[model samples]
Target: MDAKLAQIREDREELEHLLSLAQRARVKDMLSINLRKLDTEYIVTKEKLDQAQVAVTLGQASVTNTPVGRQLDANPVIKAYDTTIKTYSWDQSDKFVKVFLTGLGDLSQVSPDQIVQQFTQHSVSIRINQVGDRNLLFNIHHTGQPIDPKQSYVKVKSDMISIYLAKIERGRQWPHLRASDEVTQKPIAPPKIDETADPSAGLMSMMKQMYEEGDDEMKQTIAKAWSEGQSKNSPF
Candidate 1:
């Protein structure tokens, strides 16, 4: 999955370069279409990888018990001890979003391996094992904005657990910490493409829709690429 993602990213860069340099309308549109497809594939692949890793980690956690030589508890009453950590503060800088989980009771003393955390693009789950009488859990199913799972990390502080979420796009401020905190309207879906018709037309329509829905930086990128394609002569 990692190798596939790397290939997709490399192909995207090449296509983007061709799109910027191509003078002919047909060639530019074709490059644009493939670039969009690559972007979609990369996102889907990365998400699957994240989920798979999380599942493996959870499985490992469940199977690990006392050493083989140690005696086991006879008919151990497995009391469900999952305490939801609700008291948290969040702050963001240009590059990272910081989440501080409070009331975890001196996490600095706990072993790093005892803290189980999983990160996805839009969510985070942190489980602090053997914390007092119960396991402390801090979970967000959906964040206010997307984060880079690969670069994000956690730090155990003296009084709390600090989560540093690397922003996918730098300098984009989050409106709220969680998606549920704000009343957000559902995003409009792109118009369905008709395969029977000219494929370039469908590609152009999709590109226009993306430009409309994207952020300021995204809009600038598309506009610049289009402008460059129009002005430059095709090297090929």
Candidate 2:
């Protein structure tokens, strides 16, 4: 997964550079060609990356649920570390809450410090200990007084592999926290594109639309393709 992500990053960087050069040279034709190719590649790559991430997260969850996994999580050494770190979270009402987050994709990529930085607004501290390859034990600490767990909530950002403390109804499971509404409602499949209508023209139109409306990453991909085109001396 890491290798694939690295390669994708390299590809994206090259495309971005090409797009920059195309714009600078004012080569409208080359720019248009690169935009279409980049848009197509970006859509495919993004889908692959998303699927890979989901696989990693699901694999982690599976491993973490095993008997040995449970034992590792419950280890006294881990408990001691959690106590030593003094990490915590508080709700909007300023009530203390305990948060356990797991099933994260690319756990090795995210550091405990990064987690703390992400929750600076809540003034929450965090301690993350890797129980094994697939599980991370989080100890969250809040400066405020303890409150009812019922009034507290867990906000899971599936895309970011982040878990934030929230104020909502209780009864939601921990470690296997549910995804946010936005994530759940997001489309699982890409939009359909016509393939039979003058393939090149149809693709160009679709790519143009996607480029204009796509997110930052998609735009970066279009840019990268232009860069790649310039480097290879290819129109596409």
Candidate 3:
């Protein structure tokens, strides 16, 4: 049962990472649907594992007097927050913006008092106490828009923490999650093409530019496609 739960959880995490890296709208939709299915399966499997453990514990009550059983009871497994959450996702509605911070480990055993939140008119910070070896910290120095800090709040869940920011202006929409995104960086000009250059040269130049400017996942996808094309065209 433990092995089954672990496998399901691993699958769910992988699907989530792929969904984050997915580029196309169609692909994102497909991954999102499949990820949701895996999430449900993980929850069901976890419940079953818990039930099995409880049954075993009940059956072993008589053996608790033994040294081995006593030691086992004294030393429980501690799952720590070893994985740092580096990125977050946000969405907005008519009067609030919701920021989701995932990858938090096993908050079911953690108390609400252990989680601390600080909010200002335009920023928010979160700290989780006693995450085994280290404390977890998450902060947004500046929000895209002003929020009513008095009304904003955080919620801790078994898997993640969510921050709800109340929009000061009732129905106004936010342009971005962070204030930094609102300042547009200067665009890089496209590569210059000569009229006499080979038609394929122009395509190659465009691909090079994309590879230079794209994110890590985009660069990887382009490299994979280029390798497959070269392999298909090569002849011994």
Candidate 4:
């Protein structure tokens, strides 16, 4: 899974790069041609990379921490299983969420590059590879690990891998969503999903809700975010 995620990371980046080329086409014909190339490659490459990595790491240890050193000191398959067991994994609980956020199932019909573009207008767009999406889905469903409310479209978005990267970073930097806010002088409460509506619309609503209901002092605190959509910014 991790490997596939890495390749998807690569593929997503590459397709996005190509999409930029396509988007830059001045002529309508060129636009269509470039767009087609980008969309098609994104679909095919993303799937291929995702599947390829999954094939290797599925149901196994991706990285071998202590393969023959401690766990299998005298095992016959020591050499055979010496490889690391650290790879991306798809848990039964998060399988659906994984495909959903990665823009694999329903959103797959749309061009990933375009979808990513809708959020920020940065020179280079970003994508959420499967691994990070996997983690985000886990947090969403199991741990109530609130995704950043600032990521307004996260509800129906395919920008997970990157999203999790932010979540991880926030956790590392702040220890909790309760970020420091000099204005309110308090940490914000984590966000929780209330309903399952149109994923994108639901997300937008969720963000507005947070902003409206949050303590006035904390509103500014939570406003700081990683941005998605077309503005030359990385996925938040």
Candidate 5:
């Protein structure tokens, strides 16, 4: 999939270059013929890239549908935990709620023991497992209760868990954070246009340029190419 995506990107770059050349050429007819071909290739490659992206996303989702993940999802306490922490917007992949703790500052300075202590104070039971230097994987269970052998644990990132703890410290109730508080929509800016640049010479001008630049033989070839490209039955 990665290789295919790379190839598509490379193809797009090449197509863009060809399109630029076509737009600049003085012979309109010849340039138009090749421009259509380039456009078709660009569109097809773009569609393939989009399909590949969707397939990759679906593949990731399928991994989370395994037997263990299903069992964890079905657990009553885990469901409640999910409902309670939905405001944090942690990544719920696999049976564990994987949180990327790298967003928080200084993992080295943050003591895992201190974090576990804080959660205990808040009546949340969790087992902290540090993965490498940055990520802290949490296995959440009912406070002070031993994890059942049959029950799968819920996971959370240390950073989000810290935020949850902060809310508790402020005397906020369980599920205290509202959905609106967790999400804010940013307005998207319109694409910038360079006003000083030549207003695109347009397709007709490009075709004229192609015709003007080409020799007699080139002009004949371009005319044929254009006719073949424009044919309704042609499979270009």
Candidate 6:
């Protein structure tokens, strides 16, 4: 992803260089291309960063040792947190839009209202501006701050219903749009098995099926390997 992002930046820079020539077409290209790249992340990144921060918090609170918990001793600042959140967001948007488009049951379920709520209710700052003609048509701004997860304001209460509808409509028409870079990352699920739970479920499931269905010779081979192993726990 970093490579991809760098390549895009390089391409964008080339376009910007052309703009120095004062060519109308190159200037238009520079504006159009750069806006698309900007638009892709402007709104969604902050939302995703906030969501990821909550996840890290939840993981920290969990009884089990997790990546975040293990790294807590590192005393990471917000800067260290950002790249992970960005990666999380990129993967999420890719998977979500891919799957969503594959089986688009109803755009209504996409919930633009909920998205709007993120902004209006929680003081998230998302701005949108339409820029350019046919060559460079796209939203100019969609950047925002993270909403306070604890807030309960209703600034977009009346507007949300229609706003949500607009989101769905836009989503259907332009799955890869550089429009409202909305965060579609599912919050990490609560742990099903924690610090004290049966840690062998993962290895047990695999080994159990292998043994029960194995021929005698294969079972003997597995037993030989097992005798040298038999781990104290499973990591799943």
Q: Residue 148 deviation, candidate 6, in Å?
A: 32
Candidate 3 Cα deviation (angstroms), residue 37 = 41
lDDT of 2 by residue, 191-218 (tens): 3456444434554565566567656665
Candidate 1 worst ten-residue window by lDDT: 68-77
Candidate 6: residue pairs that collide = 112-164
Candidates' C-alpha lDDT: 0.67, 0.40, 0.64, 0.32, 0.36, 0.32
For residue 220, model 4's alpha carbon misses the true position, in angstroms, by 47
Q: TM-score each candidate.
A: 0.46, 0.23, 0.44, 0.22, 0.22, 0.23
Give one digit per residue, the lDDT tens place, for model 5 in 100-140. Answer: 33343334444545333224321233333332322232322
Which stretches of candidate 1 lie above 4 Å from their native place? 1-80, 184-236
In terms of lDDT, the poorest run of 10 residues in model 6 is 129-138
Candidate 3 residue-wise lDDT at 41: 54
lDDT of 1 by residue, 1-236 (tens): 78767766665554556444444333334444555565556556766886687666555555667552122233332333557687889999999999998866766668888789889887687878776566777777556778999999989878878999999989999888765455344433433555444434555665676567655655666687777766775665
TM-score of 4: 0.22
* Candidate 4 Cα misplacement greater than 4 A, ranges: 1-26, 59-118, 121-236
* Residue 199 alpha-carbon offset, candidate 1, angstroms: 43
Give the local distance difference test score of model 4.
Answer: 0.32
Candidate 2 residue 82 C-alpha distance from true site, Å: 38
The clash numbers for all candidates, in the given order, read 0, 16, 0, 27, 9, 1
Candidate 1: lDDT over CA atoms? 0.67
**Least accurate 10 contiguous residues by lDDT in model 3:** 76-85
Candidate 3 TM-score to native: 0.44
Clashing pairs in 5: 26-209, 26-210, 27-209, 27-210, 27-211, 28-207, 28-208, 28-210, 28-211
lDDT of 6 by residue, 13-55 (tens): 4323322322232223323443344335433444465567767
RMSD of each: 12.2, 16.8, 15.9, 20.4, 23.2, 23.3
